[model samples]
Target chain A: MQYPEAIAKLIESYSKLPGIGRKSATRLAFYTLGMSDDDVKNFARSLSASKSDLTFCRICGFITSKDDDPCVICSDESRDQSKIFVVENSQDEMAIENTHDYHGLYHVLNGVLSPMEGRGPEDINITSLITRLSDHSEVKEVIIGLDASTEGEATTLYLARLIRPSGIKVTRLARGLSVGTNVDYADQLTLTQAVNGRTEI
Target chain B: MQYPEAIAKLIESYSKLPGIGRKSATRLAFYTLGMSDDDVKNFARSLSASKSDLTFCRICGFITSKDDDPCVICSDESRDQSKIFVVENSQDEMAIENTHDYHGLYHVLNGVLSPMEGRGPEDINITSLITRLSDHSEVKEVIIGLDASTEGEATTLYLARLIRPSGIKVTRLARGLSVGTNVDYADQLTLTQAVNGRTEI
Candidate 1:
């Protein structure tokens, strides 16, 4: 059956997102149609605004709204800069931040090492992380806070092999986190447990 | 955690939809940020286009992109004007059309009768439906194709009580369809059974 071109277009856009199927997309489109004109305008405006407003912090690679070189995490004096926890993405950054247990700063890798997905050490911010380590001798420990996936494991191994010779302590989040679970999906208690039970590599 | 105003706005817009939680909205906002400029433009365009391009058919209340006074269903020579099935929304029209079992026309109520929500016969297209019936003397049977919900039951009773006085046969889709299931969610076989086994109201 044919739908209005506008409705069809809206449904198509909604379906483009991850996990949203055609039926769900159509429902969303109809829901939007029922909304007021102001709401629809706000929805459209936000779609473009998110891309233009948010920026990756230059110092720590964490996503932040500020245009300053150092994000809130990097600039905060109370946080422990000596212990840097490296994560796979910004979502993990939020997860860890929610626990209020991690007083250390974060370095987002953007993605894990995955040869199958054509992702490698060079493709990520590994070189920059190494440079940061060399430049900042005060950093005592480097915690690999990546997920428990195959790529997370490979990246941990690669990072450990590179930093072990530097005489800096390299650690990883504990195995308390279940296999196949992404760091973003983990609950606060599980993430806290993993952080507290970290093991030296 | 402070997000950029634009990102926050985007997340808020996504949270307005049904079933989408804060986390899902954030994920969607990030995904939208990663989309290409053309895709973003297309999405925005689709929203406005659907709203502006489609018009509700005056005769049947079905939304159509056509500029014609009566929509395809109302104007089609092949369709049996004598048999009209009334539905609550346009999606139900699609569900019935998918089966291709009925060559009859449709009448959309825009919504079901719900006194609790302050919706009455006048709030929907009930008046227009009455006008259509009075104007079309050739019409033989009127089928109420509403869901088995409280509002649907109310609308059916209201319509049955009103239309029975006109001396024309009034019928409803059969009891084969399970209660609380929307017509759009019903399978083809179940919908077919409901349509074929229709009884006098």
Candidate 2:
């Protein structure tokens, strides 16, 4: 009445991921059974290699190969060193980098400061940002590109207040109604932020 | 702008499974990076072991560990060998077993006949079922437990016709309005089936 031991173990592991529940995990495990042997081997190898072959950049906290310490963004001297676009994760850094709009370097905070979850400033990569900033006097501005949630807002404020005393410029990513989003359908918070942060053309 | 090579490979592997898109894959891959070394190792080991440590039951076509051929259900002699529950996958077999309502053995077809998709009798486990039926005179009846979809219905009817000639009784799972479902909200097809299959209470 139970799944075979190997299958049950795989299902349990798959369910450990975010958003994947018991049903989804079961479905995924069965699907894996149907996959070609080569694909399964590759998938298994990739899972192992991700842990063995990858490490976080010490300065920026971005993911990189184990051999590379500072990551490509940090090692590149051609990029702007004066501004550090801080985000919650490397995925956000990639999203910004994909746009080809910002020429500055990035700093990954790994997570937001959520007091509701007992995640304080010390829990995330905030102190490293301060250290990186103080160590490099050339770094002029810190862009607090955190989420628009309450936690993000609070973290941005905390970082801004902490950095401004150093006489270095501190700002946050602008909040507004998203592009292509209908004004009538936009949430109250989004509309309020758009109105409050209105700019002249 | 792309993810680090190892991370990208892991994300690609994650997205290969059902229902996981690029964004979800990226999130899962990053989460894997955050998991402990031991947990990641276990996940990788499970993935490899699923393929290496398991095999299909030769008789029932259900998943079982490599050393066990006919699976637990087929090998059990105390269960009712007079009836067989036929299903499309091992997951379906597990679902029926979880209900604890049916004590009969199960036969997994692995897939249903889909003529629209060019799948015919030869593609699925139909021939094996026929062989098993003729091999065992004790199997007096076969209960078709496939899904209510078009392919399932087709396979059920096809198999019923194929085995009924040999004087073997073939029955199908009932089709009616599900328990606790709002009848008024049920679709027209379901209503029609419910009306057609009504039994005097």
Candidate 3:
């Protein structure tokens, strides 16, 4: 039988999310029905509150509470202002931060250049990064830490061309075989990068 | 850096879902952040509406809009009242209905007996089913269409014992190897069931 209107609507809403298909959406909607009233309210409230309550950092374009405009990273005095890591999104920034090797600040591009999808440099937060760089001469290095995709390469090239004229050093995350990955399973591109980026023993 | 309160809240909420992990939850939260304001509002509205605007069918214990108290299936005159198919939840009922073979009514048990999880016959909608059966007197066959889990078996046995005393024919879904499944790959229990439930060609 067809789901009731409310359940169907919720399923539709869930299916619109990334990585969630119609079947998973239906499962999720049914799971929601089993949730307590308070939990359901909290879940719904969080969905709306996350969008309406948070503000983007003015400098880094990272998400932050409305009261903290530049976000914790941008506002913190301990973070190295001399280097800025440019990433595709806040999740990427978080991933880099989790590594604990980089103490530099971050610039969230929000998305990469996907011309096929009508996503140009203007579509993302590139302008903010450019403005931040131009306004602050202290940022000596701009590290492009994007995904290993066509859009990422295009965005990196675009950013390099734009930032190179300003005398700022531009770099990218090393594209090599990832940790715990078997050499036999490594793709040709990764193998090539691993050989190209061979470090001294 | 720590996620903003709103983003963190959303991720936590998403992670609470059955199949979603922390990484998937984070991805979903980011996707939510990228959603248009109207879309986000609608999503949140749908979540709340699905919880608040839906009610359980009084007769069958199935989910339905608040206005449709007995639900479509329970109220429909075309359904064969002589047979009541018992399922663990609304999703199971939907799955059975999708097959299109069952023209009888349904009785949602809401959940199966799981002593480990503190769920007993008293915890679910079994009492309502029993009440419906006794009051109606038309339900001749009670089909238990629960999952092939230990909990499902226990519930089915319990239900069979309860209904047999009332002189009602209690049946279960035929358990065997699934269609198109290779016999070699089938589990031992499934193989056993397949052998036991063998039919004459």
Candidate 4:
């Protein structure tokens, strides 16, 4: 039986995901066939809804369901507003949250500095970070919690230099994490250690 | 800055794809930010299109874009209608087609018989296949071109036994495929030899 063009197209789209080859994509496409029309519609709706419902927090750049300008992290009175742990992305924020070691808020750079990939400090939200730091007088500590990769190191150095004039104590995650590993892939114990052993730049 | 709720939701949805994990999903989700609104809409449309447009052909059970009763392979007049190469799914049909080795048609069983997975002969299109054999007097050969896995072997045995009374030749792909390997993952040369040297059961 020939699948309709739309089914084939969806299979192709599923195949584009990492590790999902053509065969698996077809399986997933067929799985969708078993789904109720309403369920399938809901799944498709969720795909677009996620893109439209979520927004980045303006103050710390973390992803949140709300668009309240400051987000929960920035607005929460309990969170340590004086210290900001800078991360490469929201996944890192999730990883750090899983560890439950850090009480301070987070700042997602969105990406690291990768010259080979043509990604510079300006390519991400470094300017916005600097602006946030300059605008907020309460923030005293800026911890660079980027990955331990070459790009992450470059980004760390760049951000440290950029934020030093603001008189904030710039620090980074400790050397416990292996080189070339992203914070998101790190285990809970390793992440906790990295957070606990943060050092001054 | 935190991504909008819609963007975060899209990233979460992307993460559900096989092998995407979280970080890659985020990257893909954010990459969509660079895409034009039309492109994003098109991506979503293609996804739903694949689901809504395709249907399984009633005769050969191969997936096709045509809405006509039987798929192109089932309706074609010039092809060797006497020989039918059975496969586990439509992707397997494509894999065999990529080699340009077989001109005969295909019968997609949808899946192999795996009792451990609670998949019996009735679970797949075995009944339809029996009906097709009894209904069509022209079919001369039934080729068991399934995977080389345990389940594939079980399905092949079940099919061979069931079709023995049909007075048609029942054959399987030669042992060119490694045991426990899927036909879809096999190299072209191996699969070609398997198809070319198929022996009667």
Each model's lDDT: 0.85, 0.92, 0.91, 0.78
Give interface RMSD, every candidate, in order: 1.8, 0.9, 1.4, 4.2
Model 2: DockQ vs. true structure: 0.84
Judge the docking of candidate 1 as incorrect, acceptable, medium or high: medium
Q: Looking at model 3, give its docking quality level.
A: medium
Write down the worst ten-residue block by lDDT for model 3 chain B.
Answer: B1-10
lDDT of 4 by residue, A76-151 (tens): 8898888989998877887787788888888888888888999877889888888888888899999998877778
DockQ of 1: 0.57
Backbone collision count in every prediction?
A: 1, 0, 0, 33
Model 2 ranges with Cα > 4 A deviation: none
Ranking by TM-score: 2, 3, 1, 4
Model 4, runs deviating above 4 Å: A1-4, A18-24, A34-39, A177-201, B1-39, B177-201
lDDT of 4 by residue, B145-193 (tens): 8987889988999999999887989999767777787999999988998
Best by DockQ: 2
Which of candidates 1 and 2 reaches a greater TM-score?
A: 2
lDDT of 3 by residue, B7-84 (tens): 898999999999999999999998898889988898889889987899889889899999999899988998998999
lDDT of 3 by residue, A1-201 (tens): 688999998999999998889999999998898888888898889999988889888889888899899788998999899999999888888899989999999999888999799988788999989999999999999999998898889899999999999999999988887889999999998999999999999
Using DockQ, rank the candidates from best to worst.
2, 3, 1, 4
Best by TM-score: 2
lDDT of 4 at B94: 78
List, for all models, the DockQ compared with the true complex: 0.57, 0.84, 0.70, 0.36
**What lDDT score is found at residue B44 in candidate 3?**
88
